[model samples]
Target: MTVETIGWNTAQRRGFGELIARSWSDAGLRLRYEREPAEVLAEYDIHLAAGTTAPALPPSPGELVVETFNAAEAVPPPPCMLSICFCLQPDVKR
Candidate 1:
């Protein structure tokens, strides 16, 4: 329920991929990837949509956007590039 901006890195990207896989599996939701994590990070922009099921794509700003259902009842799968973004940010204790 909290939102923050994050930058990209390899460790973070890999972690995020693992998180996405885990989240989807835990929620019993299946994810179909257009590209593998490494390939996507190396080549495409991440798109995040707050209110739609349809995956957003290029021409958007930032490295990539993590998409999720806008509905409160829906459990969002982890962002595809979350780990990458996390890596870009400084480690801060919260």
Candidate 2:
């Protein structure tokens, strides 16, 4: 599969980290993200390309990583999928 990760600048990454923390504590924000992930991301000035599907958040907060997979061009892999993993944690012991 062809995997592409969005190039996030330092500022964008920082914003995303903050967004993650907020969403973890706010139920409403999490609900909005589930329904309209793109809209929620836009608030942080993170926009996906046209025709790109916004990924859903993990069951629980941990880290923030977004990866897109294109299966049309690549062989194998039944269905294409977007992966959003990891969470922004502040010095929590593993």
Question: Best candidate per TM-score, number?
Answer: 2
Weakest lDDT window of 10 consecutive positions for candidate 2: 78-87
Superpose all Cα atoms of candidate 2 onto the true structure and report the RMSD in Å to 1 decimal.
12.9
Q: Once model 2 is optimally superposed onto the true structure by TM-score, how far is the C-alpha of residue 94 displaced, in angstroms?
A: 32
Evaluated against the true structure, the overall lDDT of model 1 is 0.36
Clashing pairs in 2: 62-87, 63-86, 63-87, 64-86, 64-87
Question: All candidates' TM-scores?
Answer: 0.24, 0.52
TM accuracy, model 2: 0.52
lDDT per residue as tens, model 2, 1-94 = 1113566677766666666666766789889888887888888787877877765554554543344445476576544233433334445431
Off-target runs (Cα >4 Å) in candidate 1 are 1-5, 28-94
Off by over 4 Å in 2: 1-4, 59-94
lDDT of 2 at 87: 37
